[model samples]
Target chain A: MSDVSLKSMDDVYPQSAGGEVRDYFQLLKPRVMSLVVFTSFVGLMLAPGTLHPFLGFVAILAIAVGAGASGALNMWYDADIDGQMQRTAARPIPRGRVSKDEALALGVVLSCFSVLVLGLATNWLAAGLLALTIGFYLFVYTMWLKRRTPQNIVIGGAAGSFPPMIGWAAVTGSVSLESVVLFLIIFLWTPPHFWALALYRCRDYSRVGVPMLPVVKGPDSTRTHILVYSFILVAFSLAPVALGFGGVAYLIMSGLLGAGFLYLAYLVFVHRVGVEADGHAKRLFLFSIFYLFALYLVLLLEAMVPGMMVPTGFEFKV
Target chain B: MEEEDLKKRKKRSIAIGLMLVGFAILFYAITIIRLGGDVFNRPL
Candidate 1:
């Protein structure tokens, strides 16, 4: 028997036959949603004020939905390219499970719903930021910047960075230096993280006609840029410590993790082109995920542990 | 023709089921621990 038959008769079905609900969910990119929710929740928790549990839940729900809306819109716009890339070929729009028009409509509905509900439930500031995030991700990153320039993810990263600030504003109703620091952590982290992937998957992106850095600038330049950004990320990660939001634990974690990131970038920089370079780049890319998650987790832990000696100089009053 | 489609549908269903289970584990931790919640609210 063939592998397809041995695996289960159900494996014979065409990919496009999935229903609307499942396809719609696929557009949300739930893994990305998890990161958005986690970072936003960190922002809310670290904010100076307090929110009722129910209200806090609502705010996070809205933010997550808005993130999902943006993801759907991105999928809709990138379907043409997505279909060509092995990494993205299984996505709803690319797989023909969801129509472009349907994805667009669902995105619009969720965008409005999230923003309005967030504004009404929290404050106008957070709602406005949420709306801006959707617009920036959809219009700026997806439509304008992506096809035009290799620096797309660099500037486009700002959309993803907004969540922490939005979560902060949801409670405080205004942006603060601390929230800005949180935003910077993610913003600065993006280039190195994404460029690492680009270095490994440059061919896939080029095949799909996307102007990612590795495709447009060559892998050598992309590696150098990754090293530069990784250095900057290390500096920015330490800002919370300098700003006094972090305690000893944060300092130690940031120091060790930042060194690890720098080491990976160095390896990627030194690795020979082709397979070895790709392996190093993939290693850095994977480590970058764990690095950001650990960094934020330490921040949250510092906040919860009393007498932990948070850094004590920079406090922004809103 | 219908049989082939049904088979595909079953595969999709199983994939979705596995995804939901993963999400459920994540959501359960997020909702239950209320990891980001402020102090003074112990679970009732």
Candidate 2:
């Protein structure tokens, strides 16, 4: 059985020199890595203790590499669909810059290296979480959920959400409610954030048969879902303050950002399906990226700075 | 590739290699300091 499978794999890939270092790097999806690193850093900073700076850097690097590995694996699996979408058409595997087998090999190697290095340099707990992140991303999100349902991003968001918690675990070597809140913030933010993009890119998704909310349910229904998720995201953003994981800086930033996000969602939801609706959806998509980055940046700053006051009435022990 | 072109490519490759080595060393140095390593007791 093993020999048969190995023969089939070799047949599928043949032999190619396409898996150069640069091509492998392209598989990492650097933009996504940046977000992963930032959120993981915030989680580390917000954790109750300090790591040696070098160790902290190593931990973050490991997490970033793990994220990259996941991206590589995702690209390996999604190469077919990716080729069909304009936004993803130029990716290494789909463009034949790297073969699917080469991409898979790079991903597997990096995944093992990262998880092992993290376990040795940090702790088993962080290592385990990293493993879970990779597994969930590959198995639960990519393989099972991505093409199966319109609720894909909602569930798949958990894979992206793990970084902060992994960062926290790197420091504290344990899970906490605070880390979970950080996870929730990203989780709830993902649906509307992605759905907005889906609204404008609906045709691309439909062409590829990806079953995204907009493609599967029509733009009107997708608009309503975006509004619903946006409202939920706002609530989740404010929950950190109520949960005692954030300070005044975070509250004020999140409040203002949440209002902006809601307004964008409102526009996307109400605008008639035409050029105007497309423009509104695109605006929401762009702002969602900024909204998340700003939200997390404020959280990191608040955690780093001393004597930043939080709301008085808000308190949660766990 | 021509001989002159090959020479240029080799030079470019060497330069890139050197730059990568320098960056790796710098990264290691910064990481060691950040991780609270004792410079004097550095591992061989």
- Residue A41 deviation, candidate 1, in Å? 0.5
Show model 2 residue runs off by greater than 4 Å.
Answer: A1-16, B1-44
DockQ by candidate, in order: 0.10, 0.12
lDDT of 2 by residue, A51-148 (tens): 77777888899899999999999998887678778989888866665778877887898899788767766789999999999999999999999999
Interface RMSD of each: 7.0, 6.7
Q: Where is the poorest 10-residue window by lDDT in model 2 chain A? A: A12-21
What TM-scores does chain A show, candidate by candidate in order? 0.91, 0.93
- Give the per-residue lDDT digits (tens) of candidate 1, residues B1-44: 47876876687678768856954664444354444554446877
Query: On residues B1-44, what C-alpha lDDT tens digit does candidate 2 reach at each position?
Result: 66665665566467658756954764565546546546566668
| TM-score, candidate 1, first chain | 0.91
A48-127 per-residue lDDT for model 1 (tens digits): 98886667887899899999999999987777678778889898776666667777887998899789778876789999
Error of 2 at A220 (Å): 0.8
